[model samples]
Target: MTKYVSCRHHSQSARSEHQGAVMEALEGGRENAIYRKGELVSRPASHWTMTVHQLLQHLHSHGFAACPKAVSIEGGKELLTFVEGETYNYPLEGPIGSLMALKSAAKLLRRFHDASESFLKLNTQDVHHWMLPSRSPKEVICHGDFMPYNVALEGDVVVGVFDFDTAHPAPRIWDIAFSVYGWAPFKTDEDDKMGTLEEQIRRAKIFCDAYGCTRLEREELVEVMTLRLTALVDHMRSMAANGDAQFQANMEDCHHTAYLQDIEYINKHHQAITLGVLGEIKF
Candidate 1:
């Protein structure tokens, strides 16, 4: 059975060290084991957590504060300082659907990528374990999943992002492609889609513009978006086949089918989207 856990983002209650803190569960697309306590969030730790923590530290050292601070790992749960702000899921509406939100998210993603570049250059990959395999050109550590729900917002502005479980080394476009897929949200799911294809393309252009995406990146955006979503579906099925209960449950609910449908939707409109985002034609 699929379980949905929602926890309050802010809390003021105090606790003694001897007393056990409350563990408020958090919900995400793939996992349900996350929990929040006062100012700290805890989730199941994987083999790659140390490497991810190193990346977080590197970002923090470079003066980037929009991501969670890796506190410590204990009893198989990785603890991170909670980013205090509102978070949202599907059916993007209100502030999350605003142009400002898209622009801020895009800019923030760019900042994150830029901040991570030095870390990528300083570290050797073979020594570190990552949940997802590193992609070529190793531009930055992709947040792996930078969906709306993963971001913390103050009004329409994206202030911080959490849940770094999927962070991996990949090209800028590899991450940007997936981020745009969620922010532009070329979703075919009834509950998740926001506007028409034209509207979506316009939003995509706004995002790429704010992030200052290269002409080359814009030219190849549509193909990358489709490829990214297809990779997600493949990963979902692969995890399910490998006995990951969360993924198996996701499969039961046909999440992979939803992604596949969206991939088709993007491909159907790829030309217009490519042209639209390229600013060559108005939709």
Candidate 2:
């Protein structure tokens, strides 16, 4: 990550060593244009940040610190407290790519869901428009994209989860499905490193155990997974049709085809997938 010394600090340019993590925009986050400078990261705020900010503040007060603390918005960008840790970027390998890492993510997500129950009462006014509507009365805020790259780590432990751009109110199963796709990576094997289907399902079951989902929730897993992927394909196609540069490129690159294939596999093996999730792991 290259450093970016601010023009305001022209007089102290020679003392550049005093700067914290330099103003380098880390890639891999598809939604926000993010840049890190010193002890702060600046990114353009959206309709969701305000709601997310309130949620983070609440979570912080309630003993959850796995997310960036909202600082202030200046110059059309919101400044956030920089969390120091290695991000689990793409093509996950080694310790960071193991089932234990997935377990940590599940635990953190469980904590967030537990804490987020009070968020609605705290901020009843102007719910963030970006949040998807609740499927029913029983819903919590889903991180939307709780993938490997979004999680930060120290060794194999997941320390932080960034990228709140997709936070929304939805069923617990909805969030679980999304996490399974990105973390368990339910997609078709795009790399030789991807484990066998049984291995993947076992890992998914491990995640569920760590999350402590009930038997009923376990039964709902496969269906939710299918629905999540189907909706994703629809959204991607819609985005591409709407002329989104990213989605257009994804379509041209056959990402859509890959997603469809994954959905088909999940549906074909729905019964087995449920059994895998429901089966007890003997520690």
Best by lDDT: 1
Tens digits of lDDT, candidate 2, 162-232: 77767777778888887876666665745512576787788788888899988998999888888887877
TM-score of each: 0.92, 0.85
For model 2, which pairs clash? none
Root-mean-square deviation of Cα positions for candidate 2 versus the true structure, in angstroms: 6.1
Tens-place lDDT per residue, model 1, 144-188, is 887777788899998998777788888888888888888888888
Whole-model alpha-carbon lDDT for candidate 1: 0.81
Can you give the lDDT of residue 221 in candidate 1? 91
RMSD of each: 3.3, 6.1
